[model samples]
Target chain A: MRRTAPITILALTCTLLISMACAVALGPASISPGSLVTLPNAWMIIWDVRLPRVIAAALVGCALAVAGTAMQGLFRNSMADPYIIGTSSGGALGATLSIVLFAGTGRPVFAFAGAAIATFAVYIIARQGGKIPVETLLLSGVALSMLLSAFLSFLMYTAGRSLHQIMFWLMGGFWNVSWDDVIVAILIPVGCLIIYLYARDINIISLGEEDAIHLGVNVERLKQILLFVSAFLTGIAVSIAGAIGFIGLITPHVMRLIVGPDHRVLFPAAALAGGILLLWSDTLTRTFANDMPVGIITACFGAPFFIYLLRSRMKA
Target chain B: MKPVEVIGIDVSYGAKKVLEAISLHVERGEILGIIGPNGAGKTTLVKAMSRIVSPENGTVYLNDQNLDSFSFREMAQQVAVVPQGISISFDYTVRDIVMMGRHPYIERLSSGTSRDLEICDRAMQLANVTHLAGSSVNAISGGERQRALIARALAQEPKILLLDEATSNLDISHRIEILNIIRSLTGKITVISVFHDLNLAAYYCDRLIMLKDRRVYAVGPPEDILTTETIRAVFGIDTFIRHHPFTMRPYVLPVYESPAALGSARRVHVVCGGGTGSDLLYALHREGFQVSAGVLNIFDTDYATAAALKIPCVTEAPFAAISPGARKDLGRCIDATSAVVVTAMPIGQGNIENLRILEDFQDKPVILLGDGGNPSFQDCTGGEADAIVRGLLDRGAVTAERIEEVLRVLHGAA
Candidate 1:
C-alpha cells in the first residue's frame, strides 16, 4: 500500500504533460521539434494554438469526471453521471440558444450565460423544496434534454443560412480551440474541482438525508452547493465545446468498476481517467478523420461499448 | 408522578383506530412487557409511546413534562427508540449506523468524539454484536441486525428504551438472549418492549401489559396477567395456565385438537409430536369413545383437555422438545393404551425417535396422520420415511382422518 493517491496524481500529471506536448508538436506538416521551441510562428502554433486546445480538453475532462464522481455519490447510484441528469441537457440548450441568438456578437460568454440560466431553470423545476430525489432528477434531465434538443432543432430550422454552421457546432468539436477558449475552460473547471474536493462530504450524504443529518452534516446545504457547482462547471465546459457526451458518463463508470466504490479513491481516479480518455479521443479525432468533430468521434467509439454495458447490465 | 405516563392516548391509521385512548405508566427501572395477538395494536402502542406516530388524542409525558413540548431531537435524547423496521436501503456498515445514533450528541463541525465511539462500542458489546461492528448491516443475520439497531438506540444514551416486536424474528436462543439483555437494562433505565410470545413475556418482564380491542385488558405480573380466562377472551384461544416449578411464573399452553375426530381408531398411542398430542387426542374424542392421553403437561393444551374430558391425562411441567422422563412416561401410557396415531407435526432430530413408539408395540396398530395426500402431513416424512412409516403401517397401523376413525374401530370392538 505505497501511498496510492499521490503516485496516481503524479502518473496522471505526467500523462497530461506528455499529451499536451504531443498535441502541439504533432501534425501533417510537423513543426521542426527544435524550431518549435524557438521560432516565433512555430511557437505561436505550438503554444498559442494547440497548447490552449490541449489544456481545454484536459480541464473539461477533469471537470466532467469530478462532476461524474460527485453525482454518483450524491445519487448513491453507480449510473448517476453529470450528463445523465439534465445537467448536460441544460448546458446544450444554453449553448445552442446563445449561438443561435447571439452569434457573431459574444460566442463563449453568451453560451456560458445561457448554460447557467438553463441549469438554474432545470434545478428549480426538478427540485422539490430543497430536496431533489435522484429518480426525479434523472427523469427531468432526460425529459428536459429532449425538450431542449427540440428547441435547438427549431432554432436550426429557422436560422436558414446559418443552419449548417449551427448543426456542425452542435455535432461538437475542439476545432475552434483557441487561447481565449482555453482560458474559459481552465478557469471554470479549476473552480469546480476546488468545489469537488468537497465531494468527500457527499460520501457520508449519499446514504440518506436523515443519516447525513445525524452524521453532523448540514445535508441541505451540501446538496445546494454540490448542485450549483456541478451545474456551473458543466455549463461552462459545454459552452466552449458543445456537448461531448460519453467522456463524463463512461469514464467515471469504468474507473469505479476498476477501483471500487469509495468516492475518495473514485473522484481523483475518474478525473485522471476522464482526462486521459478525452486526450486520446481528441488525438484520434484529429489524426484519423477528415476534420471530424470530437463528439462524433466519442459517440462512434464509446457508444458501442456503452451499449454493451447496458445490455450486460440488463442481463445481470 | 411516574417518569413516563400516557393519558388516554389513541392512534389510528386512516379510518382504523388501532389504539383507543390507551393509558399507561413507566416508572424508572421497570421492565414492561406488552403482549397481544397479531393485530392487537402492539406495534401501534409502542409507536405512539415513542412519538414515532403522533397519537390522535390524549397526551404522553416524561417527568411530568408534556411530550408535545419536546422536539424530535429532544425526545430522541430523552427516550430513544430502536424502531421495528431496522433494515436500511443503503449498505452502511454497523459502526456507521451506530455512530448515527450519536447525532443528538456529536459536537458541531466534528466527527464523533472518543466518548461517542466508546459509547457505541459499549452498546455493541452489551448487545453481544461486537464481532459485527465493521460488517455491512444489510448482509448480517436478522439477530445480528436487531442487535445492531438496539446498539444504535443505546448509543443515543437515552433514559428509556422503546422496542417494538424487536425479538420476533430471532431464534429461541437469540430471543432469550435479547430478552435477558433487555431485562438487565432496567437497573437504571426503563425498558418497554412489545412481544408476541407469551411465555417469553412471562419469563423476562417485570410487568406485563395485555391489550384487547385497542384498550388495556390487563396489567400486572405474568402470573396475574396470564390467566386462562384472559387468553380465551383476548386471543379467542382456549389455553391451560399453570405455574412453572422453578420460576413459578404463569405458563400458557394452547388447546390442541383431539383424536376423537376419526370415526374409528384402534387406540393409537402417539408417542407424538410436541403439538401432535392434540391431533391424536382430538381424533380419539371425535370417534365418540374414551381414549387416554398422558404424561403431557397440564399446560400441554392437549393433556389438559384430555383431563377435562376425563381421558385419563398425565402431565408434567413446561419443558422443551421431549426429555427421557417424558419418553418413559409415554411408554407407561402406551402399555395401557391401544393403537397409535402419529400426527403430521414436524418430526425433526429431537422427536424423530418419539414416533418410533409404534415400532415397539410391533403388533399394535399405528396410524400416521398427514401421510397420504393431505398437505398438513408434509413434514412427517423424509428420505427413509417410506420405510419408517410403511413399517409402522405394516404392523396393522394406517393413516386416518384426524385420528378419530381409528378410535371408532376400537369402540366397535369394545
Candidate 2:
C-alpha cells in the first residue's frame, strides 16, 4: 500500500507540473525562450497571464477532485460527481447572475457563494432525520440544478450586451487570469482539502449509520462537517474555473482503483489526480487555442470516460 | 461472569411501537435460547442490546456501567454480533471480511498487526473455516457464510454474543451443526440467540426465553418453560408434549384434529404397533377415533408421540421386552379396535402381541403391506395371524398394502 501511494503520487505530480509548464509556455503568441530576453510583453505574459491561469486550473482541479472523492465514499456511490448534482450549474448560475445583475462584482466570489448555497440547499433537501441519504442527495441535486439553470437562462436572456459579455464566463475560461484570483483559488481549495483530510471518520460511516454509531462516531455531526467542507471546496473551485467536468467526476474514481475506498488516502489521491488532470486538460486547451474554455475540453473527454467507468465497474 | 442486561428498553419504528418496556439479561457463559412466534420482537430486542437502535425509554448496562458511556470500539470489545444474514454484496475476500471485526483492535493509520492476525485467525479456527481464508464470502454455501460471519464477530474477542435467528436460513444438518457449535461455547461466553425452532432450543439452550406480543411470555430452563400450553398460547397451534426416552426431557409435536360429532355408542380404540406406525395412531386420534399405542418400548420416539396424544399407552422398557401387565392392557385395547391396521414395522420378539390380535378377532378388516413390502416384517407373524389375515381379506375386508391406501380404505369403510 505504501509503495502504491508514492508511485501514484509521483506519477501525478510529474503529470501536473509537466502539463502546467507546457500549457503556460505553449499558447497563441508562442513566444520563444530566446525572445524572452528581447520582447517586453513575453515576461509579463508568461508570468502574469499564463502562470496564474495555470495555477488556477490546477487548484480548482484538485479541489473538485478531493471534494468528489469524499462525497462518493460518504454516499457509497461510484458515480457521484459535482455536475450531476447541479453543483456546477448552481455555481454557473451564481457566476452568471453576479456578472450580469450585480455589475462589476468579482466573478469568482459570486460563483463560490452560489456554489455553496446550491450545495447546502441540496444537502438540506436530501437530509432525513440525521442522515443525508444517497438517493435523496442525488435526486435533489438534480432537481435544484435544473431549477437554478432555468433561472440563470432567464437572467441571461433578459439582459442585452451583458448577456454576451458574460458568455465566456459561462463557457468557463481561465483567460483573464490574475495573481489575486490564483491565490484565492489556491487558498479555498487548500483549506477544504485540509478538512477533508480529517474525514477518515467517514470510512467507519460508509459501513452504515448504525455501524458508525456503534463504533462511537458522532455519525450525523461528522457527515455535516464533511458535506460542508466538500461543498465549500467544490463551490470555490467552480466559481474560479467554471464547471470543469472530468477532474472532480473521474479523478476520485481512478484513485479508488489504486487505493481501496478508505477516505484518508482516497481524498488526497483524488485531489492530486484532479490537479494533474486539470493541468493536462488545460495544456491540451492552451495548446489548441488561447481563448477556448477548459469545460468544453473536459466534457468532450469526461462523458465517454464516465460511460466506460460505469460499464467496467458494473461487472465488478 | 455478570450477565449483559437490557433494562426497560422500548423501541419504536417511526411512530409504531415495536417493542414496549421489555428487559432481558443474557448470563455470561450461557447459551440463552430465544424462541417466539413470528413478529415476536426478538430481533428488535437484540438490536436494542447492541445499541444498533438506542432504546427510546431505557438504558442497557454491561455489568453495572451504563452502556452509553462506552466508545464504539469499547462497546465492540465487549459484544460481538452475528446478524440475521451475512449481507455481502461486495466480493470482499473472507480474510478482509474477517479482518473487519478486528477494526476495534487494528491501528487506524496502519495495517493490522500480527497480534490482530492471531485473534482473527483464532476466530476463524474456532468457526472451523480456515480453508475459506481466501475465499469470497458471497460464493460460499449458506452454512459456510454463516460460520464465516460468526468468525468475523468472534474476531472481536467479545464477551457477549448476540445472534438474530442465525440458523433460520440453514438446512436441518447445518442447523444441528450450528447449534452444536453454540452449545460447545457454553462455558466461554454469553450467547443470546433467537431461534424459531423450539426443538433445537430444547436440545441446545440451558435456558430459553419465550416472547409473545412484545412481552416476555416465559423465561427459565428449557424443560421448565417449553410446554404444550405455551406453544398453544404463543403459536396458537394445538400440540402434544412428551418426554424423550433417552434424555427424559419433553418435546412438543403439533397435532391437528378435525372436530366431528360421534354417537355415544360408537366409541373406538386403536392398538397401534411398530415405531413407524406412529403417524397412523396420530391420524386415528385426529379423526376423533380413540387411539392407544404400544406395548411400545420407551426408547422409541413413537412412545413419546403416543404419550403426547394422552393415549392410555401400554409402554414397555426403554430398550426392553414388554411387561405382562402391558400385554394384558394391550389386549383390552385390541378388543376395542373397530378396524385394526398393522403398520409395516419389521416385527420381532417383544411385540408379538401385535400379531395376537389376528386370532381373537374373527370378523374385521385386516390391512397388511401385502407381498411386495418388507418381507422382514413377516418374521414375527404366527400361524393364526396369517390364516386370519387371509380369512379376513377373503371375508370382504380389504387387503390394503400401503399405509395411505389403508387410510383411504378406512376412510371409505368408516
lDDT of 1 by residue, A1-316 (tens): 1136567667877887787778666654468878866777887777776777777877778777777677667666555565656566566666666667777356555555555555555666777744566557667777777887788888888988778667754667777778778777766656555655664466556655544543345666776677667777777677767777777678767865655444556677777778777777777777677558888887786678767765775685
Give Cα-based local distance difference scores for all models: 0.70, 0.73
- Considering just the first chain, candidate 2 attains a TM-score of 0.89
True-structure lDDT of candidate 1: 0.70
Error of 1 at A84 (Å): 2.6
Residue ranges of candidate 1 with Cα displaced over 4 Å: A1-33, A102-144, A161-173, A177-201, A208-229, A246-248, A251-260, A287-291, A297-316, B1-124, B127-142, B145-170, B177-303, B306-402, B406-414
- Best-fitting candidate, scored by DockQ: 2
Question: CA RMSD for every model?
Answer: 10.2, 4.3
| Predicted structure 2: clash tally | 3
Model 2: residue B225 alpha-carbon error in angstroms:
3.7
Candidate that scores best on TM-score: 2
